[model samples]
Target: MGNCCGTVIEKAGEMGKITLEILGGGEEIGRLSVLVSRNNSGILLDCGINFDENGNPQMPLYVPPKRVKAIALTHAHLDHTGAVPLYFVSSKIPTYMTKATKDVLRPLMEDYLHISGYYLPFEYEEIAKLFKNTKTVKYGEQVEINGYTLEFINAGHIPGSMSVIVNVSDKRVLFTGDLNLAETELVYPANYREEAKDIDFLVIETTYATTEHPRREDVEKRFIEAVKEVVENNGIVLVPAFSVSRSQEILVVLRKYGIDVPVYYDGMVREINRIFLSNKAFLKNHGLLRKAIKDFIEIRGWQDRKAILESGGPAVIVASSGMLRGGPSSYFLRKIYDREENGIFLVSFQAPNTPGRLIVERGIFEEGMVERIRARVEWFDFSSHAGRTELLKAIDDLRSSLEKVILVHGEPDVQRKFAEEISEKYGLNVIIAKNGDKIVI
Candidate 1:
C-alpha cells in the first residue's frame, strides 16, 4: 500500500447538494460503482466488475485516487468488490465493509485470482494492500470521514451485505445495494424502517423491477419434493448453486424440510460455509446452518468427488458456480447428464450464454458442444432481491421523505418501464442513469 495519493480532481459543489457520478452498474446489473461527492471530496461506493461478451473483465471508469476519501463496499460479491483492489495499488484508501464481509471476501478474491487473474488488472499484492488499509463497520453503526457521516444498514442480500446512508451538509442519501425484501432461510429481509425516514435522495437497485418472485414457501416445497422424487427413484440430483448465499440457503431449506437423503456439498461452498459458521452473528438462522452443515458431507478431494458420482445409492450433490460457468458442477454434470434418471436443478440466476441457461433452454451444455442431455432440468426462482410488488411497497414505505429517486443495477429497458411506473404512482422525480451520468441532489 502506498501513502499520500494525488490531489482532488473535481471542484466543490453547493453545500446542500450532492453530486453522484455513475461509474458503472447504471444500465446493467454488474460492475457497480458510484461516486458521491460534495465540496470536492467524496467516497466511492462499490467498485465492482463485469464480464464482457468474450468473457473479458470490465472494470469501472477510473477516478483519481486522491478524489476519493474512502471506499465503501456493499458486500463480498466480486461484482461489487472486484475492482476495489485496483484503488489500493496506488493509494492506501480506507475501505469499509462489515467484519464478516472481510472474512468471506479474502477467500473469494483469492479464488477469483486463482481462476481469472490473467484477465484482471490488479494482483495478489493489491488485494493484500486492500486489507492493510481496511476498516470494519457494523450494521447500524455510523462513522464520519471528511465531513460526511457513513452509516451501514443490513441489506439482507447476503451475509454482511449492507445498504449505505451517506449524510453530508444536512442532506441524507440512501444507496440500496442489492437488497432483499423477502426473508430466506439464510437471512432476514432488509428492514430499514427507522433508517429510511426523511431521506432526501434514494439510489435503489431494480434488479427484479419487472418480475415478481414466487412464494418462498411454495418454492421450497417444490424443490424438496423434486429432490425426494429423484432420490426415491435412485437417481442423483445435482443442484448448481452460487457458492455464496444461495448454496447455504438451499442447504438450510433442505434441512428445514427434513430431506433425509445423503447430501454432499462441493467446490467453494465448503469454505463459504465455514466462514458463515465462524461469523454466526451475521446469519439470521445460524442453528439451521449448523444443522445443515452437520448433516451434509463436504467433498474432500478428487477421490471423494469421483466416489460420490460413482456411488450406487441415490444422493444429492450441491456444487458451486451456479451458472455452471466453471466449477466441479460441470464435472458432475458431464458425468450424469446423459442419464434420464438423473436431475439437474438450478437454484440461481443463469446469465445469458452460461451452461446452466443453455441446458435449461436448449438441452445442451455449451454452444458448440451438442451433447444430448436426457437428465431432468428445472429452475427455481430463489432470488435474493426485492421483486416488483416488494419494490413498490419499499418505495411506498419511504416515499414520505423521498425527494428524488435514482434507479441503477438493472437493464436499461426494464429500468425505463420501472421508472415510468414509479413516477406515475408516487409522483416523484425518477431517473434511470447511464454508465457515466451524473445527478445532483
Candidate 2:
C-alpha cells in the first residue's frame, strides 16, 4: 500500500465472523504470512520469504493489499518482513512494529538485496516511504486502529521482538512471532501471562513444536567450554550467527560466562547491535548488554579481517550469514577448516541443505558440493523459538477464551503432529494450516 495517513476504513455493525487465512507460513519454516478479516476489511500479519534447499528465497502466495487497512510487523527478520515494500498497493497502509524493528529494517533489507543479488521490485526510496507510514510502538503499548486494536509485547526472540494481540470483531487474537519464553542476557522472555488478555483465538509459531531444547545455562556452558578448548590451544573459534538476534545473543552469552578472549565481530552485527543498543527502552537490560559487549571489538575493514585471519587461534570470531552460506564467516571457515585445532561452533538451528547444517551434520561447510573439513565442528541448539514445553505453557496461559489454535511457520509434518498433540492435550480445536486454508475463528 502506498497512500498514507488517510481516513480510517471501519468494519461496522455486528461481529458477523472473523476469517483467518494463511497467505504464507502455513506449513514451511519461512514466508510466514496471514490475513485476518471480516466483512472484507482485512489486516496483514507478516509477509516474509522462504528459502529453498538451494539457498534461493521465494515469497508465499500473494494477498491483495487493496482490502488491507494496515500491516502489523512482529520483527525485522527477513523471513517475516522481507516482502513488505515489494508488495506495494496504491493506498499506503500504515505499519505497526517496535522501534527496534523499524530501526533495523533498513540494514536487513539492504543485506537481503546484497546477498540475493536479485533486483526486487521496490527501491531504496520505498524503504523510506515504508518508514514514513510506520507507527512505531513501544512494547506493551496499545494502539487502537480503525478495524482493530493491537498491542505488541516482548516475544523474547531478540531486541524489540514481540508477540502481538489484535483485538478485532470483539475477539482477541494473539500471534507469537518466533517467540522465546526464557530470558537470555540480552532479551526479556515473552510475558503472555499479562499480555494475552481475553484471547479468543491463538495463532502461534511451531518452529520448535516437537523438540525440547537444552537448558540455556547448560547450552551456554557447553558452548563456552568448546570455544575455550579451541582458543586455549591457539586455534581460531568461528561462529556463524544470524545478524539480527543470534549474533548479539551469542556475545551476551559469551560475556555472561566470562570467556575472556579477543571476540571480534564481523559483518552487519555491529550496526545491528548499535541500533539495538541505541534504544535502551526496548531492551531487557540495556545496561547489562552494554557491559556485556564493552570488551568486544568490531571488525572495521579488510585490514581488520586480514589481521584477524592472520592472528589465528587464541581468538573468537563471530560473523554473519549464520548458515555459513555467504559472508565473512565463509572466508574464515575456509581459512581454518583444514586445521584440526580450529573450531566452528554453530549456535543456531541449521536448515536443510544449508552449509551450516552440512557442516554440523556431515563435517562439511562448503556451498553446493560438500567437502570434509578437519577443523572441529560442534552444534548447540540456540534457537529463539519456544520449545514444546514453552509453547504449551504459553498456550495454556491464553486458553481461557482460546477457541482455536492455528499452527504455522513450521515443517508440515511437525505442524500436523504437534497439532494432534495439542488438540489431544488441551482438547482444543487445532488446525494444521496450509498455504491457502481459511477458517472462521
Q: Pick the candidate with the highest TM-score.
A: 1
TM-score (C-alpha, index-matched) for candidate 1: 0.96
Tens-place lDDT digits, model 2, residues 1-441:
111111122332125677777878977888998878777667788889877666667887776677678888899988899888855534478889988998999788876776675547677666767888889888768887776888888898888878888888678888888899975767878888887788888889999899998788888889988999998899999999988878988888877778887898888888888998898877766765687667888888889989887777688999987988788888888888888998998886788888888887777765564458988888888888889999999988988778778788998777777877777777787777777777666
For model 1, name the residue pairs that clash: none
Error of 2 at 34 (Å): 0.9
Tell me the whole-model lDDT of each prediction, alpha carbons only. Answer: 0.87, 0.81
Q: Which residue ranges in model 1 land beyond 4 Å of their true spot?
A: 1-17
Candidate 1, residues 265-367, lDDT tens digits: the string is 9999999999999988789989999999998999988999888877744889999989998898988998899888889999999988788989888999887
TM-score of decoy 2 = 0.93
